[model samples]
Target: MQLVRWGILSTAKIGTQKVIPAMQQSDLCEVLAIASRNQATADEAATKLGVPRAYGSYEALLADPDIDAVYNPLPNHLHVPWSIRALDAGKHVLCEKPIGLSAAEGEKLLATASRHPELKVMEAFMYRHHPQWQAAKRLVEDEEIGALRAIQVAFSYYNVDPKNVRNVAEIGGGGLMDIGCYCISLARFLFDTEPKKVCGLVENDPNFGTDRLASAILDFGTGQASFVCSTQMVPYQRVNVFGTEGRIEIEIPFNAPPDLPCRIWHEKEGATNEVVLDVCDQYTVQCDLFSSAILNDTPVPTPLSDAVANMRVIEAIRASASSGKWV
Candidate 1:
């Protein structure tokens, strides 16, 4: 309970470059091992990360009694199955975002977590742990932005490589599933309500068989959220919230740089103010938070139920896009 012994599920770049290092930097987490399908890959990752152990197969890492938890950075399609396997092996899990392909799959993950109530299972939406987002939420709740009205989110990046897992349809690749989920989760977090209806427009890559661009509107009854996400557009990301008498804008909404100051701009009545937060590594905060939750038997910031709610909206968006009708 003093320190959470961690085992990484893969040698994914996200893990090797970002999440793992962030976790390693936390005093509450000790990344003891890393695994990859290829032994040499795992060994190399372990050496590079200063991890003491390496395993050729994920099962070997899961079987290690020393590892109390796992960081599942596997492909989107492998998330649920491997997370379930980890839970079955008595290890807590911090799975990557979009925890499941759909709401039904998310429900299954929840059911699995329910059976192992002692272990903590969380979706790795690292941005939620960032101080800037926390500050923005506090300001919104304090009504500095007045009554909430609407939210606009834009997240895109140009990546057309057909060989990348994100561009493959069979592995659950799409702009909505990849980056759009952030838009949905953020809207839900700010409004503190689920969307009553949703409408979407989608365009797929003919050769890749995955959605490259998408626009969606989420109706929250009292408020609305609109977003555009693409895998083949200029690199850009931002979020703006409009209220009855004021508005707030997040200069670096998603995928914020860990070393740069985060800014939140607020405008009200004829006055404008900017709040600056010190640079922070959100992934480390996320890991430490989860570790504390496990050691203290408390709740994680983003639970499996939250993942289900987000996935529900995502499913609705897909439905609306396909049927050419609001869903």
Candidate 2:
């Protein structure tokens, strides 16, 4: 099989910490090139990650004829513009989430994506593609957790630094945009529908003038979902699904490694079972999927449309938080 050549748009921390490593681990993927604004940084990342080529600028890497896709790990503010640029350059783009700061922002990007039927553009919500997540969806659909009625998810990590993007307001910074998005996305995924209502709260960071913590409640028609997302708490996360008959619990749901699964707790009819699964490096799985999609003309499952709904809920949450009322 011819490998799908990948060109990373930036040498960002996430590229080093998770994405690049995952790409290197996948057989169908090849890290052909990486670009940093400065050639030296690009060269350093290329050398460290064993990528064959490095470019001094984003434009140069996008123009590489051999590169079929671009993995955009750029900052939140750069995601939309860079992703459209990648698509315009005739390269498929797998962008990191949240794809945009607001629903309209996502819509604009989707408009650009509409022009590129030949190219795929998607947000990199790796968890959605993980096997365990597949299992979770199956379990819910199979009636293991019959008649889903509620979902509770939390994704939070302490962000003591005010200068980082997570705590800045100007560059689309806030806990909601940075990480709460995972909770918002996952809830809707399990429900398999857009939320009907969104209401949320936030704890402010005086130093940065950004929301350090955010929590939201969503009504999904048959079930109600509540999520607490933060950049100001001790690290904590969970994704729990409840039905009429039983419930399944995931201890570390959102950012779980595909190899290290969130434990599942099923309880019903006076019986309880504990399931421990291993699902680590979903990022690699995602990279492999993107690579194969581009190389084989296969449809990429998680496209911009998948993320637009999530962003709409996020926008509503921000609105709810600001207005101190339901949205």
Instruction: Kindly report which residue pairs in candidate 1 clash with one another.
Output: none
- Candidate 2 structure quality by residue, lDDT tens digits, 1-327: 688788999998999778988888899988899999999999999998899999999999988899988999888889999998998999889999999767788888999989989988889998888766877888888888789999888787887776677777888888888888888888888888888888898888888877887788999889999988778888988888899998888766667764555676777766888877665588987887887788778888776888888888888888898899889
Alpha-carbon RMSD, each predicted model: 0.9, 1.5
- Candidate 1's residue-wise lDDT over 106-219, tens digit each? 889999999999999999998888998998898789998889999999999999888898999998898888899999999999999899999999999999989999999999
What lDDT does the true structure give each of the candidates? 0.93, 0.85
What is the Cα-based TM-score of model 1?
Answer: 0.99
Q: How far out, in Å, is residue 91 in model 2? A: 0.2
What are the runs in model 1 whose C-alpha is more than 4 Å off? none
Query: Residue 319 in candidate 2 has what lDDT?
Result: 85
Highest lDDT model number: 1
Please report how far candidate 1 places residue 192 from its true position, in Å.
0.3
**What C-alpha lDDT does candidate 1 achieve relative to the native structure?**
0.93
